[model samples]
Structure formats: C-alpha cells, structure tokens
Target: MLLPGSGSDDRFVRSAFAGPLSAFGITAVTPVPRPGAAVVDGYRAALDAAAAEPGPLVVGGVSLGAHVATAWAVRHCAALGSRLRGVFVALPAWTGPAGAAPAAQAARATAQLVREAGVAGALAQAAAGSPPWLADELGRAWPRYGPGLAPALDAAAVEPAPTADELAGLDVPVGIVALADDPVHPLAVARRWCAALPRAELVISSLAAFGADPELAGRASLLAWLKAGGR
Candidate 1:
C-alpha cells in the first residue's frame, strides 16, 4: 500500500505509484484520509487498513506519508512480523523531532496563511512564490482538500519522524528516494536515514524529475529496493 503526502489523497498516490509498481506486477492501494483528521491519526488508520489486507505488504509514501510509514513500521513490526514486506520512503521531510525540519516549519507557515486567508487565497499567495509546475500542482490539489488541508499541514508540521532507536531496530528492507534539488526534502535527511537504518538504500533524483513524472517516485524507490537485494 502507498500513502499520499499532506493535503494529497488516494488519487495523487495512485498517480504516483500505480505505473511503476505495475511494471513489477504489484498492485498499489492508496487510502484517502477523512477531512479534518489529524495527520498522525489519519495515517495510522490508513496503515492499519493496509495491514489488515492478506499477505505481506510493501508500505510506502511521499513526504509526510513517508515519515508516518517509518514510524508505523517501528511500532508494529513485531506484531506484523513477516507480513510487513518492506518500506519505500520518498522525500523524507525531516529527521529527529518535527520542529527542526524546514518542511515542517514551511507547513506551519502555510497553515497559518491558510487559516488567515483561506485555501484559495493562500493558494494564490503560494502560486505567486512557487515555480509554475508546483503552483499548478498545488492549484489542482489544495482546493479538493478545502479547509482540511491547512489543519493537516499543521498536524504534519508537528509530527515527528521515527527516532534513531526505531531506525536501528527496523529489520525490514528499506528504500529511500531523495530529491537533491529540493530544500524541503533535503539530501542530508535522506542520507541520515540511510546511515541509520540497518537494511536501507538511498537514491537521489531531482525535484523537476518528480514534478514532470510522479511515477519516477515509485521507480526510484523500487530501484533502491532492488539495490538492497529485495525481490
């Protein structure tokens, strides 16, 4: 199962992963969080839903979803046992605690802006400052989320990544994809994760590549998994 980033839903997740996973003959399942659900809570619920399905599961996500997936793996690995196949983490937004990451800080700022200006107004402000492609992407996504987007961002902004201890304890094969040119999803964060996790591999790509083709997110993660000797 794959999870979407903050403010994104099942549609975006499917768009990002279905093509690449299909190449491997794997079906992708994405869960959409209810509006107004807190980030950690919503994602945990999604994880639970995925875990309930029969067979071993490869869990993956982008940005906030990636962070949450790692945390869930740490918490549930014992109970899940071999049913947890692997984890594919794309664009890990932060290491350590939540407030330290620039992406979290930016999300907080964006949430505040959304609270004051509303989603449309905030999107306009963001579009003015963002590259055309990012602007277009957000323009398409944010409205669909409506008032829920800001709160979700705020929730993610405060949510923490898996601790170093958690990373060390993880036994599953792990794949990470980092966008080299994206400040919010720093390469250093990705490297830190690779260094900390026992069975992890990292791959670097550009944000533009991700923007142009979301399926590359899946491809990068899959490549990292193959590098780690996962079947």
Candidate 2:
C-alpha cells in the first residue's frame, strides 16, 4: 500500500508509485486521505485493513506519508513478522520531533496562509516561491482538501516521525530515495534514517531528474529496497 504526502491525495500517490510497483507484479493501493488531524489515524486504519489480506505487503509513501508508514511498521513488525515485506520511503522530511525542521516549518507556514487567505490565495503564495513543477503540483493537489487544508497541514507540521531508536528496532528492509537538492526534505535526514535502520539503502537523486520523471523516486526506492535484500 502507498500513501500520499501532507495535503496530497490518492491521485498523486498513484502517479508516483503505481507504475513502478506494477513492474514487480505488485498492485499499489492508495486510500483517500481523511481531513484534518484524522489523517494519520485514517492512514493507519487503511494499513490495518490491508494487512488483513493474506499476502506479503510492502508499505510506503512520501514525506509525511513516509513517516506514518514507518511508524506503523515499527508498531506492528513483531506481530506481522515476514508478512510485512519492506518499506519504500521517498523524501522523508524529519526524524523524531518535528521541531524546527524545514518541512515542518513549511507545513505550518502553509497552514497559516491557508487560514488567512484561503486555498486559492495560499496556492498563489506558495506557487510564487516554489519551482514550476512543485508549483504545478500544489496547484493541482491543494484545492482538493477544500476548507480542511489548514488543519491537515497543521497536523502534519506537528506530528512526530519515528525516532532513530524506533528505526533501529525495525528490521525490515527499507528503500529510501532522497532528492539531493531538496531543502525541504534534506538529504541529511535521509542519511540519518539510512544509518539508523538495520536493513536500509539510500538512493540519491536530484530535483531535476525527479521533475523530468515523476516515477524516478519510486523506481529508485524499490531498487534500493531490493539492494537491501528485500524480496
């Protein structure tokens, strides 16, 4: 199963992961996001439901979605055992507390803008400061949340990702993809995660490459996972 990032929906997730995973005969399932603070809970519930199925499953996502999936894996790895195959993490924003992280701060700032100016105004403000591709993505995805956008952004800003200790305890293979030039999702953070996880590999790419190919991160992550010994 794959999940979307903060303020993103299933459509972006499908575009990012479905095609790459399909090559391995893996069917990617992306659940619609719940609004506001319910976002994390909703994602966890979806994972629980997917776990009920009888096959090995790989869970992953981007940014906030990556954090949630990793936390879920940490919480359930013991019970699930080998039923949980591995994880595909793309652009992990932070580890441990969200405090002062660029991505967290950005999310908080966006939330405030959404509240003060509304989605359209917030999108315009965000687009003005972002690269063309990122701006276009925000334009397409932000309005989908409607009035719940601010609360959802706030939730993601404050929600803590798994700590280094938590990651160390997770023995499952992990494939991580990091954009070397992405300040919002720092390469240092991805390195931290790769170092902490017992079974993990990191693939470094550039924003230019990712912009040219949306599937670049997904394919790199899955290949990294395989390199880390994930079947």
Candidate 3:
C-alpha cells in the first residue's frame, strides 16, 4: 500500500493507484483520519491494522507519508525480513532545513489564515499563482484535507530531510519520482534520491505530465516500478 502526501486524504493517492494496481492484483486501502485528529496517529493505526493481517506487506508513501513508510520499513526490516519489498517515493517535499520546502511553510501559513478567514478566504489567496488545477483541487478537498494536516505539516517540516549522504546508507531499494514544474515536490530532491541509493530511479515528469493528465499514466510510472519491484 502507498500513502498520500501530508494534507492529502488517502483517497487522493489511493484513487490514483487503484486502477493501475488492480491490473497487478494489488489491493490498497487509504485511511482517512477522524475529524480533528492527527494524521500520524491514524497512519500508525492503519499500519498496525495492515500488519495484523499479512506477512508480505509493501508500504510506500508520498511526501510526509513517504518518510513515515520508509522509516517503518527501515525500522522493521529485520522483522519483516524479505516480506517487505521496496519503497516508492513520489514528490517528496522538503523535510529538511528552513528553505527545503516553501509549500510546507505556505501550507502552515495558509492554515492559520484559513482559521481566521475560513476555506473560501484561504482558497482565494492560495490560488493566486499556483497552478489552477492544484489550487482548485486543494480547495475542493479542503474540508477533508486540512484537519489532520496542520500538525502533520508542522512535524514534517523539521525532519532532518534525507541528505544524499543519509539516503546512500538506506537498506532497501527506493524509487523517486518528481514533477519539474511543481514547487512542493522538487525535482532536485528526486535527483539526489536516485543518485544516493544502491537501486533507485528518478522519473522526471513535466507540467503537462501531471495536473490535467487524465490517464495519470505518466505519474503511474512510480506505480509500475512498485509492482515490478515486487511491491
């Protein structure tokens, strides 16, 4: 199973993978947090639930969720043994220094703004220069997206982001995919990921390759890699 980025309901990532994953007979479950709850807690609970059922569970996630999944794999590698396959990391936002990710900061700032002005008011400002599709999607999913997110984003921003030096030492294979035009998930980070790991692929996507691309097949490159890698 793969997880969504911080602030994104699991449905977003799950829907993106459901059709493609079915061809390979992979079943996915995206957990949604109860209102006003923390995403991490819900995620941990989800992971625990997943672990309760199977031996060979493959986990992957985007953004903060990606880090969580990766960390889980690393920590449990000895226990999961060969059952734990590889990881698929898509659009990893900055989890490092102050400037690592502006979107995280923007998200936090926007959250505070929303508390004051509400979703509509916040949507107007968030839509200013960002891609229309991204902004609109965020606005549409606002109700389901924001509650568990504020704390997640805050906690994620301080992650000592995986430096090339750090990633080079990871135990399992990792797949990195990025969007060139997207500021949240930077291409440079993906490049560094591919360069650092023993086995890693950096799939660079374009502006058109994301957003309006209906089939979402291009973005599915990560999913294809996941299935191929035995996920």
User: Residue 95 in model 3: shift from native, Å?
Assistant: 5.4
* Candidate 1 lDDT, 1-231, residue by residue in tens: 788787767777788789988888788888775555465687788789878878878888998888888888988989999888789999998776987688988988988999999999999999999878778778887887788888888887888888777898888899899989999888998998999998999999997898888688888898898787666
User: What TM-score would candidate 3 get against the native?
Assistant: 0.82
Each candidate structure's count of clashing pairs: 0, 0, 0
How well is each residue in 1-231 modelled by candidate 3, as lDDT tens digits? 677665566667776666665676666666764334356656767777787676667677777667666656655667777766666677776643536466567656765776776666777877886687778667656666554445555555554455555566556666666788776677776676666766676677776766776326224545546533545
Better of 1 and 2 by lDDT: 2
Pairs in steric clash, model 2: none
Could you give candidate 2's per-residue lDDT for residues 45-136 as a string of tens digits?
99999999898989999999999999999999999998999999999999999999999998998899899999999998888987798888
User: Which ranking of candidates, highest lDDT first?
Assistant: 2, 1, 3
Q: Give candidate 2 regions above 4 Å deviation.
A: none
Overall lDDT per candidate, in order of appearance: 0.84, 0.92, 0.63
Error of 3 at 160 (Å): 4.8
Clashing pairs in 1: none
lDDT of 2: 0.92
* lDDT for position 130 in model 3: 68
